[model samples]
Target: MNVNPVELHEVSFAYNGTEVLRQVTLTVRPGEFLAVIGPNGGGKTTLLKIILGLLRPSEGTVTVLGTDPVSARAQIGYVPQRSAHERDFPISVWDTVLMGRLGRRAFRLSYHSDDEDAAREALRAVEMLDYQDRQIGRLSEGQRQRVFVARALAGRPRLLLMDEPTASVDVVMQAGIYQLLQKIKQDLTIVLVTHDIGVIASYVDKIACLGGEMFYHDSKEIGQKDLEKMYDCPVELIAHGVPHRVVREHRHD
Candidate 1:
């Protein structure tokens, strides 16, 4: 039987005596591409961290791939939010991608041939194999993002979690990144945290609006009421006359 890729029941997390998440329950099924959207400081990253086993919830249970997050971490690939200084790192793309295979190998002396093959296949999947030898710092933001994705894929994860993967790229590059994801979504379950509501409807299979609480309609379509509750204000989801009505316009009488 196929197990759910992620399951969290009444999950709550707090940092430094302040609660960031409160009784948020969610389930991501196999082969699902779910996007988590919410305002800043709304525990979006915290949720991802908890799911990755990097942080333990203060309350409730968390399960990933039919097991605890830490036990199932080997099958999970994570692409964290990009940092400004990361672009200046003195590492080659090939080396960066190989880092994903760090804990998966037999001996820690050096990377095995299997690791090299995985890294190569991952670079090819992201269409970055030609630039594998190049310095990571020399690539464009979009290209760098692709390399990071390749690094994640090198681990051969069944569940992929991305945190704001396209935050720094231009509009066109953003589309390209989404298109790449579309090609790979058939093989992996994806959970992405994004503020780019305008493009999510076209790509993701479902939408989860998360604030301190979880407001999910169990479909890609999100109602105006859900958006309002997520943002804690009236939201106008006008996307320059785009037909996708993720959140309806707020009209004044």
Candidate 2:
């Protein structure tokens, strides 16, 4: 039997007496691209933390690559919603990506030839090799995001998790990033959290709608009823070519 990349059975989480996720179960197969959509404070990032073993669930079991998430973390790559560094920080694009290889090295004094090769290959994959020596602060928002992706790729992870990768980029850059992800998904499993339901449908293979509860669908074409149930309000989806729109109906009563 083919082993799943991630599995969560009846998982739940809480923070300081407030519950975030309840009875959430999810499974991700190999090479599948899954998108998680929801409103603010809806436990989307909390669920990712559980899967990454950054936070333990209050209840239920979590597994990654047939092992506990904490034990399998070395094989996973993560791209957070925002960069923690300031724009003025003195760091080069290549050096930032080289950080990903630190986890594999026995000593932090120097990077080996293999580490440099991996970092260069990752930069090339994201079309950022030409700017390797440039300061990260000098790049555009889209270019910076691509460099971050290259940082993750330098690890050669089997599974990748991204949270709001395109939140700060423009529409054209968002499309470019998603297209890059589509090519990368051929070899690894990816789970992304975002609020852009319309744009994500065209790229991901499956959708997971989360609120306090969770709804999973095998296809991106979510029904009206499912949308209403997930959002707790009447919802409408309109499609125009590759772009789509999701609108919530307001009650006049």
Candidate 3:
């Protein structure tokens, strides 16, 4: 039988005796695109860390790929928030993407032909094969974001986790990145932590609102009541640069 790509059962995390996440339980199925959105300091990144095994929960159980996180590391790929320093790093795109192979297998002194093929395929997936030899620093922010995604894809992970992949790009570029994800979601299970609630509805299959607790009904259709509870205010949901109803008509209170 197939197992879920991610499972968290009553997971709670605390730092210095302060609670960050409480009883957060979630399940991500194979080939599903899920978006985690909430206010800052809501433990979105912390939840990803728990799934990645970077941080153990203070309470409850976590499973990734039906096994312990560390053991399942090879099947997971991560794309961190873009950094300005990364843009100026003096490295070729090819080398950057090849680094993804480091996580999939035992450490090797040099990349083999298989590694090269994987990197090439990943670059092609993101349409960045032509820029393989170019300096990463010379590419546009959107292009650089694609390279980062390619780096993650090179690992051939069944589960991909991204943190604000479009944070550095403009709205148009953000749409482009989401479009790319839409194309690739058929083959991978994606759990993305983002603040872009507007554009996410058009791309992701489901949404989870995290704010020390998870408010998800296992569907992408979230109501204004849930949004207000998550954001602590009335929210006007937007999609495609226009007002969109995720669940019900907006109430003029």
Model 2 TM-score on a 0 to 1 scale: 0.91
Query: In angstroms, how far off is 155's CA in candidate 1?
Result: 0.6
lDDT of each: 0.88, 0.85, 0.87
The 10-residue segment with the lowest total lDDT in model 1: 238-247
Mind giving the per-residue lDDT tens digits that candidate 2 earns over 155-199?
Answer: 999999998898879999999999999877778899999876657
Window of ten residues with lowest summed lDDT in model 2: 238-247
lDDT of model 2 at position 72: 86
Per-residue alpha-carbon lDDT of model 3 for 78-137, expressed as tens digits? 998877888778899999999899875556677889999999999999999999999999
Per-candidate TM-scores read 0.94, 0.91, 0.93
Decide which is better by lDDT, 2 or 3: 3
Tens-digit lDDT track of model 1 for 179-234: 99989888799999987677667777888988889887577777776776677655
Q: TM-score order of candidates, best first?
A: 1, 3, 2
Compared with the true structure, model 1 gives a TM-score of 0.94
Model 2 residue runs over 4 Å out of place are 232-253
